[model samples]
Target chain A: MISRRNWIRYSGAGVAASFIPTSHASQGRVVVIGGGFAGASVARELRRLNNALSVSLIEANAIYTACPLSNMVVGGHRKISQQQFSYAALSADGVNVIHQPAVDVDPERHLVTLRDGNTLNYEKLILAPGIDLDWQALQGYDKTAAELLPHAWKAGPQTTLLRDQLRSMREGGLVVMSVPKSPYRCPPGPYERASLIAGYLKQNNPRAKVLILDSKDSFSKKPLFLSAWQSLYGDIIEWQGESDGATVTAVNAENRTVSTDFETVQADVANIIPPQKAGKIAHLAGVTDRSGWCPIEPVTFSSTLQPDVHVIGDAAIANAMPKSAFAANAQAKLCAVQVTRLLNGESPVHGKLINTCYSLVAPDYGISVAGVYQPGEKIWTEIDGAGGVSPADASRETRAVEAAYAQRWFDNLTTQVFA
Target chain B: MIRTINRRNWLAGAGTLATLTVQPRLLAAVSEPVQSVLKRDFPTAEIQPGRVNIELPALAENGNSVRMKISVDSPMTPTDYVSFIQIIAQANPLPDVARFDLSHANGLAEVETRIRVSAEQDIVVVAGLSDGSLWSGSAHIVVTVAACLDALY
Candidate 1:
């Protein structure tokens, strides 16, 4: 006669006794900031784990445009609608989903202030505020300049803006993309974007050339990407790594010119991805370290500076885990479990974590890197003899299979987190 | 052991298990090739499936470089130790990935490495014990493409 939900709860009790809420345990309130993959997943997971606890999710946008597949939109392979999701499902799942920008947070008082001047109280605050572009990091690059030269890193209007610029440029024109240094979100994203853009130009404007000015000496999946570039796009795509004097210091939006350490190149379209840091809310809460990212206890994801507040996703400095959506989702679930255990007056336990990053060289060509990590004494460490990149001499069929699986992964992840 | 059980149960309850629907064709496509390779390589050894453990991701972001760890539950003494382990990717063009030879001096019956997976298929690990018995284990992995292009800026 038990309902499905109760049946699951009862059946799981024998194995996860610590997770089951006791009658004496008081109902607590948890407030989450930034409803991206990390925030949304934690909110829903908390609700699923214990319905008695009150959960509220604060997100700036009503519709989230995912960043994982946005490059395809820029390359004209997919529509922006496919990359967007609504929060109705999370709300229906008993989370108090608020469509408001959280402007500030007071860690001592455990309060979050929204843009419209209202404050929400919580016993525990979870911050999944992702990252923000550091406009001042690069000279001549600011909010206003972004309109002319779009970064398109956030995946909404900027994604379409960059797409429009690429579509309208004259045939045989130059497309310049500037990449920031390491510790940025998605280590292999820029290379994948460059590859997809070149794929587009190869079919539409056969004579056009795409130039990548990278700040790092090397990148993820380099050998696999380089081989694909050679066999597929050949002369259409060019990459200049850090040693090639490709560190961008400034950009003249009016002239469509990007200046590196040694030279200034004028282009028909300029895509500048600047250095980044934790979202503003994390800084206002005083949880972020001097590195511009939040430092947390590796086991519980609790902020080192503010133990009552936890940070996940790209905003937190998760040792050895790259800032990708997959990593964010994985961290969110682990963090949720710890938060639940802490609320129930139990100590947090370590969990196994894994991250797999996939990048598309062409629509049918794909590559990836996988790593299994564990919480170490002070930081997270990659398990020795586990995780690696794809082999260099794989056949064409392998690439095609990986490409299809990439789409499937996107669909599955978005559905699980935000559907 | 309790913590590991909790993690597995939570993972199942978290909706990840719902996305894992094995395609029958994928299994059918690899069974013959895998059996043929096993018979051709281990001509005299009889393979069983109990002691070996193959650890791998259920859904791989990239097939090109998937990491795998293999261990067999055997005491590493001169009288009773694991001798060698062979890895095979059922659907790969070149199915034989690697083979690691071991001895009592090695102290453990475990090996870890990164490998290339050509498709969504089973990765089989077979261990040869000094007692002339072979133990086998396999993990079904779904190797997908990368999703880095959509990173939040």
Candidate 2:
């Protein structure tokens, strides 16, 4: 499962000072690929625990915009800048934040090749490449179609494009959104987007309608959303599951039409969330299984297919955990601790892992689901009675408070990952 | 320390095991318990968790405004439909967060809203169907700040 990279000599100035710590003088180097929540947290946590251990974080992007709250940006409730974060703070903490995409990993030689032809040697490597959409799976929906339809799943240009399209759309027009099946990132995300879009349409174009055609028979938080749709905006939102002919078979982006087996839907704006797979780097490193996600050792998050390498975040097949930002951060913290232990010649022990995800139905309304998990015979198992969705039938004031908490949670999470 | 090779093959079949199935099933196969309210309300019904999905954060930064959504798998036909849906917080002072009365006219068995949580607790949802059966789903959340007990007044 190792892919060797061509060696390139690095300047001594950056390499010399990184090797000087006394306590971890023997741990060698730890290189983390991808600077998203999982990779960044592992790199920073490793340095925090043992300064002597050489750690390097390689990232393709200079700034990170979170996918958690990107829906709000598309809904115009938030600006993209508000969700954007910098790695300068992590750099200030003595992490060598290399802004380069890792091209290859050499497990036998313990070296990583960067796009700039530079190579980094490591005792261990952590990979967190997030997700890549399976564009081919969605007929007529590719990277080019994404530019027009705009899934807005990732937080950059696609988000802004969706917002712009919604703004310019005529009143009483249609908005068609197609959701992929399970195992995609943010299971409840598509529903939240529909709710927010419905809210926006209600305010600007009272006659407009939102149509959500889902591949699955149901989605997370079904009752709460149904109730909100009934009470918040009646007749403005229509959702169809597989039973109701909502499983999208193909999408005609040129005509802004999405076709299910039985019905063809036309929209002024269509958002087709395609099927997903592990990012390219995961496949390049040969850590992914048939599921298009990496399998890892539960205790250390090290790759099951590859040794001396760990897979975290959305790319890993964490069956017990969803591919959420919070889960990634939690896994990163655990991976950091376990990787450090491995370097120090200690065995990693089991621990409870936590994940909490919030979805905004509107600016003043929010909902969440949470769980506590521990290692099971197969994978991490949810602790009974430890987590569930937010209570239904909450008062307006409660919704407002939850909405406020959603904002705070976003802030808290970004700080933990980047700052 | 679980071994890697064997576990990987086993887990590959798991495919994110936390996912709740949507199709209705026999009650005895369900591992999670039916809320007492549902058990008492539909005495003859077999309550299960599948076909009912609750969307909410696993963690709450504050307890005040936890956004949530609930959806059930149903054809929404007259012969088989969801009659009502109820939301309950296991640890709240008044556990009945809200109850929604639905019918075949609703076209979909789903709802989205926000709720105030007093503390870290599990949220329970139960749906009564036309066939005199009950379906339920629950999710646990950790709330760092209390929303119900805040001294805003």
Candidate 3:
């Protein structure tokens, strides 16, 4: 997905609306459900492979808002507008970007049913519908709490709401962040949220502490985060890991406080990241595992439970990989190559995969981890010592260069996926 | 004007239909046969057992990327070595799963890796013993959230 900053400010809303309601649509068909990273990537990729391939991307929202860098938007670094991007890029690339929600997928008929009552048929269907919030997993913390404490996982307005909440808070007002345990959409997301909040906290409200209540005892990039937190915020930020029994099991909307299994914490603002699952369509299509994700072959990415269906990105089970946009991009590219092979009647060749997830520790401070894996014993096995966290003592100049590279990385990825 | 199936699509499609036509091939492979590649490589008779086993997480929170380990219950003796092992997810999109080739030179008939289990399903590990015996083991897991769904969500 594109970052919220570029998407919001950089994109012109009415940009693609002209060519969107097309004068004509061609015959061949390639249906892409989600317009996010993987969906957009696959859609653009298939077209690039064969311009004649009928490509249509169905996004739930007309304006494609991004989730990447949404933490910055929430931290008040910049407005959400700066993070936004228009679907016009997809259009320019000859992708039929449909602004509609996809409701059903009938593999038997090779058809996708849209909420608008339109049925799209395709020879090759790519479903990159991203993720959906599993509100049922947490009681009393439904969409209502999301309004009070937005997940901002999907970006857009929720991100703006989070920023507004942060901006309007009185000095010394508490900020509580709720982080899911594991296997969520973004592994380092909550930690990044905390870091960015601490960034905001350090600048704006020194007396106002930012409390991070996590569902896990530890988190991604722990060493770097703790060190930075200590160096930057010192006593300003208080982190309560899961071991402290601070997992929020319930939320009291009236009281504006969250109740964990152990203790109750009240804050001026809260960010509750609910459990996540595949898009509702995957479950409806009966391709999702009991864990609410799709299982696929390690080599080809074809669905394990279903014939003729393939799952990619965050929706598929790619081992030893974190749920980050970069990993999703890697999975999508790998799947794209696999799809090309499968379409050509050749089986996908097994090969080593490389994944590098770069997270911004601070504006000028960046850290990353890289991994390489190959199919072994019917699954992906990480090559020993092939990947690890960025060194703890990395210099400020290096971090600054890495941060700049991070921006360029997002640019390059979006261009690769959509442009 | 051009309505021809690409040779590979035709092969994949025809191979799929041919399996339905050849009931005996499916049944034969089920009990005593092997994957076409394996069968082609080792056209010998039955497998004589040494031993093979798979180790994996008893439970995983995110089934998308679950770790798995497979080991042959064997002492890589020249006289008796586990030649190959296949790990298959009985319920994944592709049932063929992953295939591994081993020899005495490797010293160990063991492998460890991470697997994405779509749902709570049985992971089946089949081993080809040095003597040409095929032994199998399966594990049933309860996956709270499968891997693929996380991506598409």
Candidate 4:
């Protein structure tokens, strides 16, 4: 973990270096699209590893709202500002951070075109565009419908909208959440959201209910979540898996209802997490596969279909590795190391990769899953006898400790990647 | 060198190989719980550090079902083959995870199955050969608390 003192020290250097022009005579240029955990980490690490290399990070938003702890904001336990981060620290670290949307990519010419009709050239390109919700996958759920039924998946204004809706809802009203199938970002996120929302309603609106409609029969950390619901929230939170005909086929945004083959249920407020695909920039770069995600070579994370282009984070199809911030940070570091080696005319070897995902069942209750992975012949293989979840019968003290650790992890990770 | 030996040559050379025994190098390195389990299971045999390989995730997402694969470097011929394999999770409420019996008719000395790991602990796999010598391999797994939430924003 990086200390705040170290971050301040780097910021001091950035202040002094900002006056002088960056040297461009050493290494080739690297252009990274997207400024989330993956892209931001790679850009900063590249500058740290080889200061001579010119690195430019393109992101559409000026302030990034994190998805990790946004559930707290939705549950009215935390403020949205707490989840917001700026790129100023990264800019101070000698990274050329650009606040603009990337509209097109010409891989043949190694050029990325911004929305303002400006283009950036690069020797190597890294894409960490994350996931874009599939609007067409669910009928009657488009950008306009999102205004009525907030997904809150991106953790910004949508998060506030959902929170406000819950606050104004009637005491006996039902808040419905629809979850997509497997391979979506944050496999266990909807449940965590449900848990936190239920906790909020249990205190403020005692009679309100939170219903989860899942497209899949099972979810990550199922037993722990179920036990938490049973012990903490009781019947305030109810779940219907795919086998129970809870798969949402369409959304009637006007009536605030979702329809499955079995029935159509109206809700006071609907949160729809639609199906997803690689972000637009990834698709423009021609790196995504039929699965609508980028397939990368296990060792270096380069695109299997395109040369000199690498994809990381949720945009990449990482076997056995869930789409989480921890996994993205791990992948970004490895990608940075490999990209450096390749630029120096050396072969890239596999490195130690691990992921730790922590979820908050309540304000003081937390759980996590961790795994160590190795690059196999074609994909990543989870190392045997190494990783598992928390014990079923853990004490309250254990849960509290994990909750503290989760906060520390968020602080350390955000500082490492963005600050 | 073993990879180049033919099946017929391996059978013919079994008589000389049967007398060779590997040093018990892992005996001093294992934890106390693992040592106790090993001592109870193979009191008379020297548990050596070769021939057996245990493949499991270094970290697991769930402790309820963890996939484990164990393979032994044996000819599996009538003359020299693996007889049985025993698995033990030193920290589990029940130390014994599972046990598998094998024979020459099985063709290969490999077993794949899933086991529940209660916590972070060292899992040991012991293979008993037809010659009465025991070979072992072990892996340490960390069972973390699982939340599985993605921070992609």
Candidate 5:
């Protein structure tokens, strides 16, 4: 799509640079909204692609924590400190990172307004704000339920809170996790959480059970996780897909009972992962469709309704890919490439992408699934047989091998997105 | 090109002057054959007659990722055991989602995991019966996001 090199090349040729601020056309200001995987990656990559191109990233949260391995943090395999990362890495790459949310995107004026009331004009704008939870969907739950039974979808404090609650659970306690319907972030995530908890239950509290009260009958990486669970935990885990009447309707946090339309479930801990939509910014910008997601052109990540604005990550509706860390990172790379090319006046072409998601079944064990994607007639198509789940009935030694590879994969992904 | 020419010539022979064209490249893009294996090598299934069971949620909230349990009522015995259990999501990016190799020593014929559902489609699980006969079952799900292998533009 838009590549940075294309911008410099084209700006120096047939066309002038876009989105200039007043007569000060000499400044190369690039403002990026959001600090998650997509935003952080683009901001860092843009600066690295061109040191002379100024870049500023605005994120509401000071720490750009990852949701990728937060399940392990919650499972108590590793401390939350393991999940904590700093923006110093990004800053070292010459990016001007700002800890604030974008309140407005005035494409017509070529400016972005932040929560702090400062307007930053930009020559290029990148929007990577993550998804927002539909807190109002459940009947008995509201913003109040989230305070008690946190979704922990976004990493950092929410993830830490869930971890603390899990650590405090009784030896024979039940953990009730509700998986919201589609279009949410990290499809295979909740299952990994259950697997990790069950892995812990296998060792510390053999009598304890993890009950997954799912909204759907299945999940991502089902075979690998199930194979791992059966081998590792035995009956330590109980799952209710749909035939078990698994639909989450409400939550009574004070009593720790999650209510579905059919019945109410009482548990020691509850993690209510609700359905989601595009970030509120998209809604406010009048960019969301009836599905509560943002639809964009399959070619460039640009908005179909708005100009000079691109939404990536969980916030954007990339319909073919699973909402996982790999997809977001992949989208960021393609978006960056497209942004650079678009700025230079060359049309972008289609290219296949690869994504692999690694989930921890235990500290020393792991599983992964991968995909190889190419353009279909209208959308991207993951080449059949190009990917599948990690082998089932894996030896513990093989699991350990997968675990090592998983760690390496995480490090490589984080580096790709930030470094 | 040959077929288009022949058809056009046939039309011309019938006194119909209409030029026809075709794109020959459209014939090569098709899905490959998917195979499911059990245990270490052989793709086998243990049939306990009517004891095979799969537990899934009735109404799935998210089709993107669903939780599932496969339980077969086969006694984990040395002579009589469920050899392998395999699942296939025909609509997912890859059809063969997961397969498990089992032996009599494992004692339980139950497995659970999270699987991706590409759309509102039926998920099939095959328990290769010990007698070369395969017992297959299916479950339908409503996937909201519909697995986006083509998700990115």
Candidate 6:
């Protein structure tokens, strides 16, 4: 059922059909690197869409912990166990699930080298490795400091670490969270984290304070988040936008202090979410740009730096779409579809993409932003009025419903990926 | 347990301290059992795994967006139609993903939607018959890569 329209167009008398790539022949090896939202979705969709294609998913960890709703974990609304998942389902479905770190990729030879000193060849390679924290952005914040001042931007041990620090601090102590510049994973995540932490401190330590030291002038869903902070948390939380000269210049993780141009502030606990770049694997594969992110063709997700290599998820520069799980999943399915057609010698057909992200300001309060995106002349663009954040003036009941919807969305999205 | 916080000054100047492991008691404070909402709601209802169908992919690449279609084999007549339906992801942070209220007007007991899963888990669907009996169906999804669990280091 694979289309061969491109073959006919490229050559007369159907002679191009013989030259069709048997190396990437149907039922050939399709290796997917990184088992995050983007990689996993592409691998599964590839297999489901074409059973003949042998799909192998390479992941480093045996178990996965989700970042979405991890704020709730910090707020004590949920536990980390609730977010953990295994690879049993994907393995049962015939996708070869390999738990190993892929060390390098030789695009020229179509070979992938693993940390175990082994190699695997593939006809097509899909890289969905997520983002990496850029330590250079903040002085004195490195791997060692991350242990003391956890970013918790990734959902794992760091999350628990941050939660524990908040729990152990003095009831009336100050908790400072620093936000970096844009083009990072989960644009609205830091604000959501701030709100949830405030919600936690509000209940347990009513006298406690939360300070948001931001590097950016503004943030995703700024108006809605700020409005919620004012009406819900009030004096307990203080946000210093970039306009206030809140750009953090240095950090003393051990002392829980962050220094901005204006002043150095000490805190009981500090969470410094660092600037990010494409995960290390993307750079190793030589698919990244000067921006430290992989650039890809909008329709195919094919890396501009390498042939037959596609990048998705937080690592790729998807113009209109924020680096989010939902966006990554959407991009993955499109990549799978296009990659399949390309394997079958057909021209790729682009389609509409959608992303919706929900952030909880309180246990029963929520807000969301959604958009339908399509390819533009140069990059991706959101359809007008198709995507926007939840209204600032939404009622309490409406917010509660949105909260329920957010949980439901999380469940549904997770089931779509893992169950 | 309290030492980590008070040692900030000492630790800051030292640059690094290897002894600051998180206290197990702290993680235990938030740890709880994964309890299913359906079992709580229908305590007396014996959910038999039959007469219901859950259509989903056997393998999910990304647990963020899995397509699922659930249906019950029902007569759909006023006397024999299904009353309500619930889809649950047993391992999700929130197990009660979605619930549907159906009536005889639907003419059929069916639903289709996309779901997110954090890991490899069961997608369970329970349908309440008009007689108050609950029939269920479930599909096992293998997720090579998880969704929601972000910040892949």
lDDT: which candidate is best?
4
Ranked by DockQ, top first: 3, 5, 4, 2, 1, 6
**A-chain TM-score of every model:** 0.93, 0.93, 0.90, 0.94, 0.90, 0.93
Assign candidate 2 its CAPRI class: incorrect
Query: What is each predicted model's overall lDDT from 0 to 1?
Result: 0.79, 0.75, 0.68, 0.80, 0.68, 0.77
Tens digits of lDDT, candidate 6, B1-153: 000011122122111221211233322221122123643666555566578777675443345555578889998999999999888776666777888999899998998766776655555677889998877666665443312123211
Superior candidate under lDDT, 1 versus 4: 4
Mind giving the per-residue lDDT tens digits that candidate 2 earns over B1-153?
A: 111112111112321222222334433222333234444455565555556788775444335566678988889899999988888775665666898999999999998766876654557677878887777666665443311223311
**All candidates' TM-scores?**
0.70, 0.71, 0.70, 0.70, 0.70, 0.69
Encode model 1's per-residue lDDT on A1-419: one tens digit a residue: 11112211212112332212233233467889999989999999998888877788889788999999899999998999999999999977878777778888888766787776667767789999999999888899998899999999889999999999999999899999999865688888998999999999999998999999987555788878888999999989899976687878799999999999799998999999998899999999999765578878899999999958999999987766789999999999998999999988999988979998889988898888898888866556677678888888889999998888889999999999987
Question: How many Å off is the CA of B40 in candidate 2?
Answer: 45
Q: Can you tell me which runs of candidate 6 are displaced by over 4 Å?
A: A1-27, B1-153
Tens-digit per-residue lDDT, A1-419, candidate 5? 23222222211112333433445544456778887888888878776656767677777776667888888887776766666667778876767777667788877877787675666777667777788888776766667777789889888778888877877779888888888755579888898888887876667777778888877655777777777778778888778876677878678978889987689889888888887877877776556665566666656677766777777777776656666778877887777777766766778767677778888888788888888776454345567667777777667888898888888888888776654
Worst 10 residues of 4 chain A by lDDT: A1-10
The docking quality of candidate 3, as DockQ, is 0.06
Which regions of candidate 2 are displaced past 4 Å? A1-26, B1-153
Where is model 1 more than 4 Å wrong at Cα? Answer: A1-26, B1-153
Per model, state how many residue pairs clash: 9, 46, 57, 19, 44, 30
Lowest summed lDDT over 10 consecutive residues: which window, candidate 6 chain A?
Answer: A4-13
Q: How big a share of the true inter-chain contacts is recovered in candidate 6?
A: 0.00
Docking class of 4: incorrect
Instruction: Assess the local accuracy of residue A58 in candidate 5 as a C-alpha lDDT between 0 and 100.
Output: 77
Model 6 C-alpha RMSD to native: 25.7
